[model samples]
Target chain A: MTAKTHSLERMIFFSDAVIAIMLTLLAVELPVPEVPDPLHLWGALAAHGSEYIAFLISFCVIAATWTAHHMLFVHVSRTDPQLITLNLLALLGYVLIPWASKTLGKVPNGAGVIVYATAMTFLGATMLLVLRHVVRSGLLDPTAPRGVISGIQAWSAMTTIMFALSIPAGFVLGRWTM
Target chain B: MTAKTHSLERMIFFSDAVIAIMLTLLAVELPVPEVPDPLHLWGALAAHGSEYIAFLISFCVIAATWTAHHMLFVHVSRTDPQLITLNLLALLGYVLIPWASKTLGKVPNGAGVIVYATAMTFLGATMLLVLRHVVRSGLLDPTAPRGVISGIQAWSAMTTIMFALSIPAGFVLGRWTM
Candidate 1:
């Protein structure tokens, strides 16, 4: 019942709720097929392959981000309002993923892909920023290894670079399939 | 960290991710509004009033359930495998919300509303079960007040009763608007 544990618990509880809802939301892109001919059902679904692809990609992104978030929190010992706010901002990046994917799913346009990639990049960057904050602000357990933070740094960097590159690559390809 | 803290943390983290994803997924029912006449966009958006209503109801249900979950967890002082499994099963209730909402959104039938209401009832009841188990098994903090537990019991009972009643009422009314 210490003040700090209560604050941390609130953040953890809220973060878990947000992540759970966002992860499951990916299936919203899928529709129940209603083809008259059972044989045509596969083809009918295949026709909306972009939507499926968007869902898959977004699902992986959210799952990976959740993984990273959980890993980071294990080392997080204390959370201030600022840290909670940063976490909230990072969750906002996750909230926008569905919007970005829906746009991509609907249009499959260069603009849509750019927006999607940009959103992904933002999530990666925000995670990186949080990790940096946790490490720099002494919010982590003293026993927490430097290696854990370094590993996340590397992973976050890769996510940022790959996603950021997809912007121009999406435009050059003329179709935002990326 | 105590083994209990780790177990609780894992459950909280996973549950949060699931809730977060499901809550945001509600918006998927809304279309991007592709009216050729820009003037008709508002009308187009307003046309799907039922879908919006379904979204709002489900959103509140999930948010309220999350609040309840958070409140109850504040008194939870220990954890075991059974508790974690029970928690996961309750989370399954959340996982199914999107599917029920999607059905209700697509068909808007007595069947769909019944399905949605049934899911909500399951969540409420499972939460009640968890609360009762925690109280019975002496899993709560020693300092926790008896009044807090009784208050949650009252709220949980109300949720369970209202959602459960919607089933027969859905058939009587030929629609489950609430």
Candidate 2:
């Protein structure tokens, strides 16, 4: 294999592993609430249910994100150092979900809401940044029959929408929790 | 482009889009409970909380599923007709989730739980079946570092475990909901 191919292979392996682990880490943030009695257990489950809703939202969103990432990489026959590093930066934001979840779970407070929103914003923004880098690098086949640019733009817009909604939603949820 | 590459590209695009759409659909299943009294909104939210918990668990599991699929596909350099068909079958189970959620939401009883569990079991099993076909196709570089057999074996075992847990848990949840 050429040096470029070798490097790309290593990066793909690393990226794949990191994304998988980070996705798994989401579940660890959800601590099973304490309640002995079945009745009380039901009540506790009901009480903290927003945490679950938020978790589901984040989980599904992350799945969509990963799906999009997978689609992008499928066309990527090779990657340069810059593309790999940028992709890692995007994955870093993904890996930070546990911390973000912790803060979001404590929501109804302004700081926590802002922190969570900012984290999501960074995650979405960095993903777009990485995609732009990959596209600009010409790593995509020039003869790729279809326009990947539009797909990238569409995905970026969707990410932006999610981030935008989360800001106000976070604030509202934070107030409610508090 | 070679016919194999074109066909692979189409399969990847369709599968990825379906996965993304299905993951998004999971969140849309959460309905804002009807409440005539604005003052009773909190109570309504509290009442429907278990639905949220169910959504979260399903969401996380699906995200984990997507991650697993992503990792497995990394070793596959090309796709065959049978493998693509198998993947579509696996994804069919994924797309069925919103309907399962709807059923589980309405009945919240033994039958609904069983149905949900069965759906999950089929989903996991189908994924494993697809993985096996991909590995056996020799499209993957045989000398590739990742051991195809072991990886599939581990994933297969995990799928079985998940299926096993889903059935029992479904029974318990079904009884509870009933």
Candidate 3:
């Protein structure tokens, strides 16, 4: 095999491994509760219910992000060094998902929502940037339309707005629920 | 592109989309409580907290599985119809993750733990079956050693064991926390 092929192979393997590990890292933060009295379980349940809610929302959000990432990679059969770097940068934002989950879980405050939304916005933007790079670099399948990049751009913009809106919604709901 | 190439491309796209959506599905069950009172808010938090913990665990588990999947695809540049079907079966289990998360969130019972573990076990086993098919089909790089498959098998076994242990641990912890 050519040296370039070997390098590309290493890039894909390492990138996949890192993304996989980062995706799984969110699970490490779970605090296992100690049940002292089965009877008082109701009390414990009441105190912690919001956390569970937050967990589920975050889980779905993360899953959605993963799906989008996978879709973006579909057109890419080979990776250039720049593409590899772009993917890594995109994943760096992904790795912060647990932190975003924690923030959203604790307060569901405006700050928390904004923070979460901002993280997602950055992630979405990074993806768009990568898509642009790919299209410009001619790394994408030639048969795929030039408009596909615009579709990604449009989706990124819409998702960003939605994420931003969800922040205030979280806080308003958090306050209302109380 | 050759028909074989087109099929492989479609399979990769399908895999990416499915996995991404599955990851997103992890958080769908989280509560979005309407504020009624202090007690209600806290109650929501507590419930969601447990679900969050489960989501976290599943998140990591999914990432690990994705890593394994990516690794498997590394040595093989092409895939056959049967391999695609086996892969879809593996993904079918992954798609079930959202449901599993929801179940664990609602009950936190021993049975729930068992159910989650069963799903995980099936996922791991199907992965192994797919890998075996690939190896048997002679789709892998000839330069690759027999031990590569063995390596994946070892990893999957350890992962399965971890999930099995965590199920009971999660149940006990959930009970205690509640």
Candidate 4:
């Protein structure tokens, strides 16, 4: 690979590493269920159901974000400093996911939902910004199909809109907003 | 990329992702120092110094492991089922580092040191097994230099031996084993 190609590959690898870290960090916050007796094990786990739910929700969000990123970068053949900056902005939001997820697990209230939803919204929006930057800056491969670009754009936009909507929905649905 | 190249690339990507996750998980276990007064902040942080030390030690171990993995795979032109299995075994040990780090941080006793040291030993040994498998199975590119191969072997072997030795040293040094 040429130096330019190597640079682009490194950026993708770095982004993947960051996303993977955020995804696994979701599980780090899960409390290990302890019980005086084996019989109460199930009860203890059930009591922490909200934590599990929070983990699952955040896991899905990160997974979707990674999938969109993977798809977008597959078509991207190069990177500019601005693309790198935008990617870092997206990662900043991703790095906060575990903290937000933990808070949601502990609180499971309107405030908790809002915090989690806002983090998700920020993550999604920044990722969309990355997608827009890639397209407008002509960073994609020459042969990259227009249909694929459209598909990725649609996916990113829909997720951003859903997360944005979830901010207000957090009040009405409370924990169910997850 | 051909299907075979894609498969190998995916395997490398997956390994990198797992390592990244394990590396970042070390930070998640660090407790946020809480102080009622700003003047007490440094004191509270000092009280949790062991946790920071554990995090730093584990971070270096994971970073070294990743560098070795990256070096080895750069010359690996192909992958087999056995290589994939061995890689997973290496990852199994990595996945435990955060939990071990957390235990070491909280306990900081002989037993804690032993646990953390053992985990590091397991991770290093498994990674060495991966390196040997890749070499013995002739997975490397034909153009790969013999010196690079030997250098990686030396690095992996040395790390494994050091970690193994630390298990016994843990009894004498306790927290210093980190």
Q: Point to the candidate with the largest TM-score.
A: 1
What is candidate 4's lDDT per residue for B1-178, written digit by digit as tens? 6434654786678667877767766786688998879999999999999999989988887887788778778899987667766765675577667866886676545556666778788988888888888888888898988998899889888988887887777666643443
Ranking of all candidate structures by their DockQ, best first:
1, 4, 2, 3
Q: What TM-score number comes out for model 3?
A: 0.53
TM-score of chain B of each: 0.90, 0.82, 0.80, 0.92
**Model 4: lDDT of residue B174:** 45
Compared with the true structure, all predictions reach lDDT values of: 0.75, 0.66, 0.66, 0.76
Model 4 TM-score is 0.57
**lDDT score at residue A175, model 4, on the 0-100 scale:** 49
lDDT of 4 by residue, A1-178 (tens): 7877688888877776776666666666566544333334347568888987887777666665665565566677788899989988988998999999998889866878778889988988898899889889999888778997888789878987887887898788764555
Error of 2 at B17 (Å): 22
Give one digit per residue, the lDDT tens place, for model 3 in A27-140.
655545556799977777657666666567767766766665556556555666577667656655665556666656565445456556766777777777787787788776
Candidate 1 TM-score restricted to chain A: 0.92
Q: After superposition, how far is residue B72 of candidate 4 from its true place, in Å?
A: 14
True-structure lDDT of candidate 2: 0.66
Across residues A1-178, which tens digit of lDDT does each residue of candidate 1 receive?
A: 5646765867776777766666667675576666879889889888888888888988887887788778878878887656766776676677667766876676554655666788799988888888888888889999887887788789899989999998777676553233
Q: Residue B114: error of model 4 in Å?
A: 24
Q: Any runs in candidate 4 off by more than 4 Å, and if so which?
A: A174-178, B1-11, B20-178
Among these predictions, the greatest DockQ belongs to 1
N/CA/C clash count, model 4: 0
Error of 3 at A108 (Å): 10
- Supply the TM-score of chain A against the true chain A for every candidate structure: 0.92, 0.83, 0.74, 0.91
